[model samples]
Structure formats: structure tokens, C-alpha cells
Target: MADDFNSQRATLSCFEENKPVFDSFKVNIGKGGLGHGLGEVEFAHSPLEPLKQEGDNKAPIGVFTLDAVFGYEEDIKIKMPYLYATKDLICVDDSESSFYNQILKTPKVMPKSFEEMRRDDAQYELGIVVGHNKEQIRKAGSCIFLHVESSEDAPTAGCTSMKLEDIQKIVSWLDKSKNPILIQITKSQKDEVLKLYPMLKLEE
Candidate 1:
């Protein structure tokens, strides 16, 4: 565990390669200052190709800050910020839109090329916003999130997806004070991260 990981919780998803589906696990660092495994979790990504532009169906590779626990149900208890996703919720991905890569709050109308957070498939029933191209870089990527997987074998359109139960456990355990982060580095990049954050461990 890194000393700099002041947070009480973190989710580490390691990839042997950017193969779309990878082994993932969560860590809970309590007052004792030691990490305990929450359990094993699996995530899916797009198989089309490596993540690049919008709609590539590939997940981005890098460390990302987790923001906003959102779901259709308003009763989900979490220590972090929460938003009850409604039909009005939209994640604008349009390159021309000034709000690219950001979720609009209570929009009266949907923006062009935006994802409806509230969907009939229930995939967005519970999710966390992933900070990939979050600075609103036009067409870099958008609507990245950690949400419910459509199927165990199916891949995501770019975001990371997992079992609903697994996601609920991870989200409910998150603590805002700890500033939990999601590390999505490839196996090759693992060595570099270890050199910088010696206390951190990347599992394959």
C-alpha cells in the first residue's frame, strides 16, 4: 500500500494486456492502514481496438479519478457524492458541444450525440463516472463510466462494466475522504508505476 494512498478505499483493476476483459479487485484500507481485498471483480471493454476517438468501443488505459456514484435508485447509500439518474440526465459527447465529456445536470432537452444516462436496458442502473478525457477534449472520448455489464461475456462500448452486485459493493465501500482512484494501467506500464509509487501494488 502506498503511503500517499491516504484514502480509506481504492479499486485496482489490472490488465495483463488490453484484452477487453481483465481481472479486477478492490482494496479497503481502514484505520489500521493495511489493504484488504474486497473480492474479485471482472470488467469488460470494447474489442474493436485500443481506445482513441469517440465510439471506438475500447477502454482507455491509465489511472483515473472516480467521480459521482449514480443510479436510477435514489436510496443507494454511499460515502461519495451521489446522483439519482433520471431521463433528463445526459452525457454530451458531441465534439462541437462545449460540454463535451461532461454530464449535463437536469437538461430540459437532450444535446446532440449525448448518452441518455437513464436507459431501458438498465445498464446505467448503477455507475461511477470515469475521468477519461474529462477535461472536455473534443472527440478524445466521452461517456466513460464504470457501470453494469450487459452480459458476462459481452464487452462495453468504452466504459468499464461488471456484475451489478460487485459494483454495488465497490461503490458502497467508497469513501470521499480517502479520494479513491481507479488505476487502469496495462501490464507494461505496471513497472513504471511501481517505480514511482513503490507502496502500490499491481496484480495481473
Candidate 2:
């Protein structure tokens, strides 16, 4: 109910420098693997997406942040304590979850509770957090992230998907000063977003 995120009809360029920043992105809504921009990715960033399955078809347009990180110590080292396989976790604001992406107020970490959630597996393997709290964008919510893709061909949920090598490369290069990974929509949505939040417009 709390939707504080920027919509596609609001902005254009979402980068701070004229560099080859963002690794890869989705265009042509609902397209997986790859897509070409109608004109160009005016913005250097991208937006968070809704949860997705391998064959599902839908691509949302909204601005988002890679708020925090999570995963393994040997591989994905999210700076925060958003550990998976623990009992005290939940993806609170999700329509996909019968639990709706919300972790229970009661704290108890259990992996069995998540036995049926293979879609959420990506959150653990990769250290990419998402902006799924459409209920509010401050990020005070539940389970979400851009974890390492299960299969290179695996479709993503709202969160952006990338390879382990890609994630590691991007994370290392990303300016911690820019803590959040900005996911901008394509040209049409970019323009639409700019119309709404003129102040947040990205500079080309």
C-alpha cells in the first residue's frame, strides 16, 4: 500500500559518470537473457523487479536500490546480517509468497520453513538486495536480493539477475559511496519517471 518508489514515467539518465558502469540490464519488458534498448539505456542504472520464475512473463518498471547484501562467507559476503538458511528470515512484502515476503514477528531461524522456496535460493547465493517493500521504499521489510542466477538461463523475479562472476565484478567496481545499485527502466519508462520526479532525474 505504501508505494514511494519512482515510476518509469519519471526520469532519464541514472548515472553519475559517462562510463560503462552497469554490467547488464533487462529491456523489452518480460524479456529474459538479453534485450536491446529502443534508443539507448539513457540512464546508467536500473530498477528492482518483482520476483520471477524461469518461464514466467512480466517485467515491472520502477526505480530501486540494491540496499544491502547477503549470502555465504566463502562466496557472497553481504556486509550485513541478512543471512539465509537461518530461522529468523522471511520475504515479507511479496505477493508470490503465501507469507507475502514478510518475516514473522516471532524470531526463529529454520531452513525447513523455506524448503519450498527455490525461487528465494538466489537471495542466498548472490549478495544483491532488492527494493520489494512496495509497502514503503525505506527498505524496512523482508526477504529479497539479486542472488547468483540458478541457471544462466534462469529467469529472474523483480530482482535483477547476474552471474557469480558478474556479481563479484560489479560489486567490487561499484562505488560504496553509491551503496545502492540503481536499476532504471528503459527509455519510455525513463521519460515517464522523469515527468514525475524531475528532481531525481539522472544526468547523462
Candidate 3:
């Protein structure tokens, strides 16, 4: 987790059957920091903290499912369901549209606002769909994913990002049958998170 709600960088670790699968790695989060999101569990946030919004640029804080894998490639060898991010594929971000927070092919439905799944940069070359706000809550947050970082290793608009090799490793390791999930939170919320998921061995 980040040191605080305002931090854009944090350490990420992977585990399998309560054993470390790989050494902890660094990752870049939302440029605007972190905020409460719709996830597997709800967390109590201070009045000062903000809830995730459509364009807040804040990474969601809570447990979320790793729904699928997406990339610019036509096909991938990953075990999870893969999405080929074709030129026509877009993720709707328009809260007013019926397809809010959904990924769809263009021309079939046009929303006022949406993000192209296929990008010119390498950021979207490989990515994982994070199951945040699956209920399509208006302005709650949308199109969240675990994707490759930019060339500069800069922060994302809201998605979590890491080195291409690192993200690829994660994507390859993920198994749909395992029902993989992501737990994201600040250090201050560690104790509470432990109470809910005691199996986690988070560092002090």
C-alpha cells in the first residue's frame, strides 16, 4: 500500500497459498493519489478523504477481483480470459451513457466519452482488468486496470501500473480458477485490513 492517500508509488507483492511467489516490486498508482472505491469490502474513511470519481485520478482502495487480461496483441498465452484490444474496442467512461464503465466495440454504440483500448504507447500493450465498480455506478470510477507503466514510469490517471516485464509476469501467473483478487490500501489501514484478511503478512 502507499505511505498515505497522496502517495503515487507503492510496493506490490504476490503470494500463492500464503507463500511469496516473487519479491516485492514497485508500482505507480493514480496521479491524484488514492480514494475509496467499490470493491469486495467496504472501508471506513475519514471525512477528509474522498470517494473515487470518474475523473478523480485516484486509485481505488479496497479488495477487487482481477477480471481479465487485455492487450494490443491478437492473442496471449495467459490462462485467464483475454481481450484483444482492437482499434474499435473502447471502454465507456461517460456516466450518462447506459454503457458506463463497460468495454464495447465502436459503431455498435457511441458514448459521449470513452477511452480507446488500443493506445499508441506501450502502456496498453499488456494489461489486466481490475473489477472496480462493476455495478456501473455513475461517476464512482470506471475502466480501472493493472497495466504497464509509461516510458517515464509516471503515475496513471487512475490505474495501477508497473514495468512491462513485471506486469507480464503477473498476467501469466494469474489463473481464472483461482479467483484472484487485489487488496489495495494505505499503510494506515493495514491493521483493519489484517482483521479482515488475517492470512496476509503485510510488513510494518
Give the whole-model CA lDDT for all candidates, comma-separated. 0.62, 0.41, 0.91
Tens digit of per-residue lDDT, candidate 3, span 48-115: 98889999999999999999999988987878999999999999999999999988898565899999
Best by lDDT: 3
Instruction: Compute the lDDT of residue 49 as modeled in candidate 3.
Output: 88
TM-score of each: 0.73, 0.50, 0.97
Candidate number that wins on TM-score, 2 or 3: 3
Query: What digit string (tens of lDDT, one per residue) describes model 2 on residues 117-175?
Result: 22345445545455544353222233445556556545443344556776666555545
1 or 3, greater by TM-score = 3
Report the candidate with higher lDDT, 1 versus 2.
Answer: 1
Superior by TM-score: candidate 1 or candidate 2: 1
In terms of lDDT, model 2 sits at 0.41
Better structure of 2 and 3 per lDDT: 3
Q: Write the per-residue lDDT of candidate 1 for residues 64-121, one digit (tens) a residue.
A: 6777888999677679888788888888888788877888775555567888889999
Off by over 4 Å in 1: 1-51, 106-110
